[model samples]
Target: MSCLPVCTQRMKELAKERELEHGKRIEWNDWVADNLVVQFEKLVFPRRSQLPRASAVPHWEYSCQRLNHAFVRDEYSQLTLIPSVRENELVLQFHDFETMGQKSDGEIIFLDDITQAQALPSQDSVLHLLPAADEPQSAGYFCRFAIRDRSNANAACITPLNSGLLSRQDRWKRPRYAPSKPIVIDLSPRDLGLAEGFSQAEFDIIAGLGFDSEQDMSWRTRYPTATIYDESPPSVLSHMRRGKLLPPQDVKAGVPKVLIFSETGPLVIGGGEDPYFDLPLLNIINELNASEDDFDFLVSIQPAGILHPQCLPSFAKAVLELLKKRNSVHVFSVRLPDHGISNSQTYIVLLASPICSDVPWPATHLDTKSIEEQICHLKSKNPRADDTHPTAGKHVFLNPAGQVNVYNHGTGQLPDATDRPYFKTVDFESNIILPTLYSDHGWLHPTRHDILTVRECARIQGFPDDYIFYGADKALRSQIIASFPPPIARGIAEAIRKIIKEHTAPGLDASTFAALNLGGRPQKRTRVD
Candidate 1:
């Protein structure tokens, strides 16, 4: 097994005697085995007497949780079809089974209908057909089989075929690893292609994982998606589909709802640097909130990727609840699959930037719960926006080589203090960088670092703490976070609410807000200042 070396090292640490006490030494395969190709479900397990300890093999869920942002740019072509393992399932099988030591002529063999086949579990067929001393495991052996009857599916018979043979004169058909471009096959159901059934973001991820074996199997060779300029991922993750259609929980069918992104956390700055300009974000939100009485929901998403999944949910829920209790606003989090929030029906988006860090930080969740707590401890070191909460830590402001003016929250101020301790900052997993420099943060002088806390990022974008991102990669988390439209920025619903209040009941005015009065598209925001 690929993980054997790691297992061996771990076993030694446990001591031979310590493992013996567990009853018996068992071998388990989690990673791919020495034989490169496999249809794993058919692989047999060892006797229960030699079964491995539950904790010895890693959990698939935990394995997924540790995935980093080592993302391939994107796979623009090809689709995936997960074949079922049910008795009624039909699958493709190929073989060169002539135990008489025969070679195949390089001619291709094709079979159209695969419905008559019954599968032979490796348990009943594997040991009988071992690879020869020189044959590689990837030269797998497969054959078509069918059950005699539904009642006798427990037993099966092999089917006749003009078998594929690589004779002494011709070589076996060598499968190409990379297809410089998408391999377009003439499969049926091309007309049944997905319509509006899948969202853009969900589809991209699915295509990424499926094409690796066929698309990115080599080093050196290049594909367009692997290039930086080509970022559109071609995969679609379908487990995100839903069986039920439920109405949104936080608002009435007629009321205006508002989603906010409010994170603006910061890092240590060096001497005389310009502070970041974070005022426009907050101003936009407050303006919209103040403009209407028809608004029913007030959602806030928190920063995520580092803290537990609750960062988004916790931020959303807290903000929503607080709004509800204080002003009768309703709020909720966007549900996701396998703990990931979905983009479907997500009406607004938040976009925020975290405060510059004095040191380096990682976005890994290897020890998420514990590591997050340590990062939270850093809040005690500075005069943060929410000083009572004590957020992100370990920063010393250096004297900026230059400086500028910046504004944020309710008041605009100059943050010119970088001359303190040498701002040494670090995140839960990132390596070290001294601090960040700023471009428009009120001043021209640069800080020792780049940007802010995940939560602060949430705050700037108006994502309520309750909305969660299904990731541990900071950049992915950021992209998902920023793609949203902050309810405050839109302001259309509320402005319409005011016109409705003076002119009608329940909903808003149609004269100007609705399409009845005039135009094609709604008015667009032309200025940010």
Candidate 2:
């Protein structure tokens, strides 16, 4: 009989003793000799049926005194137990039966002398005893048994007393460590340019303009060659798609681009015998020179009507001519009525200039129309516009009691006394007026019933009180005042100046400088004598 069962029981008793008193000295050698013995007659041998007759079975003996170094033999194999006693531990080294007279690879059990705690050898010691299972025969040993040491106490014993190996879950839950690699990023020249050129406010606005929907992603995937300007106004996108107009994103910084804000009626489409495109262009260039001398030019054209599709060719031709002369030009259409002007008519503004290329073109065709639509939409939401007030109009009268009475038109009813102020009538007024003080449907003075004076109109349009109108006719003066608001012009000018300042300032990289000076034009430096 093998002594494994008795040795395991004695290990539990020694563990209890160690827990009770750590100073107790254990007689490990004596204990091993008394309890650790293997009887060959009573031990169950493997492959008993394959062994020779009972007489051919090799005889073996075991004594309690010599158990420290003993062997149990059978017909096929022998098991040798070699015990070594140290101050802290008792090592029981087992030899495999396969190799005769040689120390075949086997498990080494470490038993704590005080606690009799059983554990396998360390991983390093195990690897020293058994080589990696690269061969099919060696692989079987790994699959059948699990070798572990004190580092992992949950491992199964190799002895027949506990034949169970570690479960699959236990092996999977084992911790593993691996080396990590570094991360890297590469930025292009254009990316660097954008990074340096864009301020926080501009970056925020650009970020807001980016679309990240599945539909947008799918559209991008479908048209891999499309650019950011592909979905812009049809007029601009058509020119861009045909390689006539440069995509806004491709516009270079530092170089001045012509900005043209022109009305469609006078330049190309409206029934004008002689188009005054060059006059407006020259006027804007002069204005930019007077206001911002450092910049090349900013031209704003205010036309009387919306730009129709049929007029696009003429407009494109005009733009191409400007581009040929200026190298870059951005066009925009501005509507005066959308900007709090008393007039109700929409004016087309065309802006073409050599400003900062970093700034995107403002006022797409839809954007211009959408502003008017939104204003009109808000007006339509007024309560007085409802069908219930079919006779509603801006007609006010003073009753004998000094209260304001409103007269309902087309209702055949007398004026009714109302608590609502007279100014509220303006809220329901939807008359579209031209840029003239004497127009029948034009703005009325807030306190008086007379039309707004030319000076008042100019003030409403962001002009200073002292600003003089050179035109002799009131209508002509009104037209001048209504063309473009001074505040908006100042804002656009300041923005252009800011863009130029940021892009052309010193300290930028050589690549950025090359990018800004697109034509490889040599810088004009003063000759030092």
> How do all models score by TM-score?
0.17, 0.30
Error of 1 at 468 (Å): 9.3
Residue 116's lDDT in candidate 1: 28
- Clash count for each candidate, listed in order shown: 99, 23
Candidate 1 residue lDDT tens string, 1-529: 4999997787576554444422221111111122112221121111113222342432223111222212121211111223323432222222222321122211121112112232343432321111111223453333222111111111111222212322233212211111111111100101111100111111110112122322222200212232111111111111111212221232222222233223322212222322342232233334333332222223223222102221323333332323322222112122111111111111211211011001111111222122223223222223553556533223322222242211111111223233112222334332221112221111111232433444333333333333333323333223323333333322322332332233233233333333342211123444332
* Best candidate (score: lDDT): 2
Q: Which stretches of candidate 1 lie over 4 Å from their true place?
A: 1-445, 455-477, 484-490, 506-529
Q: Write the per-residue lDDT of candidate 2 for residues 350-422, one digit (tens) a residue.
A: 4333321323333222212222231221122123544677444232221223433322111112211221111
Q: Which stretches of candidate 2 lie over 4 Å from their true place?
A: 1-295, 304-306, 309-311, 353-356, 360-447, 469-476, 506-529
Error of 2 at 329 (Å): 2.7
